[model samples]
Target: MIRFENVSVTYDGAAEATVQGVDFEVPEGELVLLVGPSGVGKSTVLGAVSGLVPHFTGGTLRGRVTVAGRDTRTHKPRELADVVGTVGQDPLSHFVTDTVEDELAYGMESLGLAPDVMRRRVEETLDLLGLADLRDRPISTLSGGQQQRVAIGSVLTPHPRVLVLDEPTSALDPAAAEEVLAVLQRLVHDLGTTVLMAEHRLERVVQYADQVALLPSPGAAPVLGTPADIMAVSPVYPPVVDLGRLAGWAPLPLTVRDARRRAGDLRERLGGQDGTPEVSVVTTAPPQPEAPPTSRLRLRRKARSAPTTAPPAEVHALAVRRERVQALRHVDLTVAPGETIALMGRNGAGKSTLLSALVGLVEPAAGSVRVGGAVPHRTAPPELVRRVGLVPQEPRDLLYADTVAAECAAADRDAGAAPGTCRALVTELLPGVTDDIHPRDLSEGQRLALALAVVLAARPPLLLLDEPTRGLDYAAKARLVAVLRGLAAQGHAIVLATHDVELAAELVHRVVLLADGEVIADGPTADVVVASPSFAPQVTKILAPQKWLTVAQVREALA
Candidate 1:
């Protein structure tokens, strides 16, 4: 069990405590989900359980945090390694070994377990997390989802009584996320392990939480209750909860099956209605008039009333090979101007590769890739920016400046824009970001926002984003939806490679499903998602046989 008694954490040279008056306890064999907006102290609270807050992070702890009756204030992280295991947001940083089997055993070896015990636990963990086939695979070569599972399995091998996970499923696809959640469920029910997890994608894990802890804002006291109790009033929630609230369900349903059981009357009411949701008009202040526009900027046609049209970016017989791995195999795809497309697939299913090819990050071994009539691989960097812009999976890879302000300034200089142009975009996408804060010190979501702002400064005809909403909360996600939607309206083609099905349903007009380095399915959003149970949104599942994909759509139809 984990307990926090009047815990408050303040970093060095801070105005006030980042987390204050937080009191909660996770009973043995239970999973507690920590929910809050971006920049809230969710990660700070999770770090306290394993003594990473004041011990390694160089912060002052006001009260006590105990795990399995071991006071973290008195004990260091290594001292409590036997009973506590922690995994941070970035899985790559957690690995101390090259291969999966070695990584799983590293923690046990550090704990000084006998070789026999370590070997048995390694085998057991590989099987438990369904990583037996990939035990010898190198960690760097694994997909994002696979790396996540490996990171978790490395900690699970220690068999700790308390597990602390920060955004455990952020990088995983829907099915893989379900597998990870199912493993946690088994641990709670069968092994009596206590789990404390913080995640931004609430729709994927809210149903699995034994209890929900809501952290409304920074330095605010947390509210603890059942999932329905917290979601009824929580600002950050899934579409199903909103739909439940709209329909006045007595108790908010956490799962699709539960919502569907109570949706019969609502379904009949919306039987023969058809209407599009009234999208809010997102406005931005006028750009600084001093900036000069770059050349080769072609005016694009507006969005077509029909779906069939020649795409701005196209891939024909695309085959990519890297280090003996065939990432893409004879793949063909296209993205039309003024259209938003969702790229969905399992981890390592060529989603990132496709995005990379579009932006010229990866060279294809065979076939051709064209973005606005220019071959991305052969296009020069300066010229490519006018044609396409990419926000890669690792946001830090694109960031090198010391401070946020310097990064934005560099974006303006490189894009030939006005001095304050990049900063304005950052304000629209991510508000309240301090100009002096070091880019390394910001949270995962904040770093992603900064990187996105840098990419958007170029105003390329085609924009490609891979896992753009990894750590963004609902409010940040809504702002991103508005920004990206605005870009699409301006005749820019957008392609997002993500696992968040709700985002795909709410924003994109088309869905392209890939598997094993090939395009398996491509069609309209409703047609593709309604047929795939794992990728379907909660509202669509509840309103089945009615062809609705979001709560906004349902509300629009009813109105």
Candidate 2:
């Protein structure tokens, strides 16, 4: 069992305790969920358990923490290495080896395990995590989801008594997230591994969690309860769950099938004329009127540009040749004037690679990419700035200026943009303490937001983002959705590669799934996400697969 007794931990050079008064316990083999907004001490709780809090982070800890009946303070991370396994939010941070297979064996080898034992454990872990095929693949070639799975597998190879993960699915597509979650579920249920994880995408995980430990931001006591009880009070919830709550559904179905069964009567009562299941569409208080429908501006908030009805003109995007990485397999894809396309797949699935190839950052070995009728590399530097923009998965690449104000200014200046326009954009988008503080000093979540804001300031016709909301808080995430929706409505061709299935269902029209550098599936977001091969649909979809995308869309479609 693991226990945090009124724990409050403060890091050196930091102003406050990342986690404060966290009190919780995980009984043996119980799957526990530690959830909260980013930077709210969720990771800190994991640190306490793994002995990274005071041992490595140099924090002032005020409470006791015990794991497996042993106080964590007395045991360093190395001492607890064999007993407690932890995978952090950033998979790259934990990786030390050069290849996938070697990384798996690194831990076991260090523990002086026999070669046979190490080989058998590595093979078992690879198969268990669906990574057997990629055993020979380089770590750098895997998708973000695959890398995260590898991180989990690397830890699990030791068979630790307790396993802790920090937002393991935040970087994966819906299908990949489901794959990882399914493995974790099996571990806890079949293998009896004590599992504790903190994740922002609650819809996919809440149902499987045996215990819910919610820390509602700092300065609050952690709220502990069963999944049902926690869902009743959580401020954040998936769209269907929220709808169920408002509609007064009993026991509040966690999956779509359950909701469908419970909602039949409600649907009938709403009155049906056509064959549609009949849900209501409240036309009242419509969101801000549709923005202009032109690719030069917003993408989603606007209707498809009238001229875009003509078949989209295809343009070549990227070309690359590398020693061992076949990043793109002579791929050809087109983006209509205002389409929102989500790139989904496991990590190293070439989602990030495809985005890079499009942006001219990573050259494809076999084919080339283009944007707005011109090759990305062939386009003039400043011209390329306006035609396409990219936000790399690593937010640091987007950051450069000392202060947030300066960062926005630099981005605006990049495309030979106007100061008034840039200032206007910065003021409206950032519009907070970001104006004065050093951009680099902010947390990863804050940096990501600022970077996105910077990208927006450039006003590119095509916007590409890789896991934009990886570290965002709930409110911030909602704001991001609003921004992207506004962009799409305004006429920008927005292409996002994300693991956030629920978000894609809310915002996108189509999805393209890549595996092993090949396009496995490409079609309407609704059609594909509903029955994605890698993952069953989100609970909302399971509740109502026909309405697989968003609650508003589902409700409207049913009506």
Q: Among these predicted structures, which one has the highest lDDT?
A: 1
For residues 17-88, what per-residue lDDT tens digits would candidate 1 score against the true structure? 989999999999999999998887898998899998889888799988988888998999998899988998
What is the number of backbone collisions in each predicted candidate, taken in the order shown?
0, 39
Deviation from truth (RMSD, Å), model 1: 5.3
Relative to the unseen true structure, what is the C-alpha lDDT of residue 273 in candidate 1, on a scale of 0 to 100?
36
- lDDT by residue for model 2 over 333-396, one digit each (tens)? 8876566788877666677877776666654455656666556556544444546678777777
Candidate 1 global CA lDDT score: 0.84
Q: For candidate 1, what is the total of clashing residue pairs? A: 0
lDDT of 2: 0.69
Error of 1 at 176 (Å): 0.7
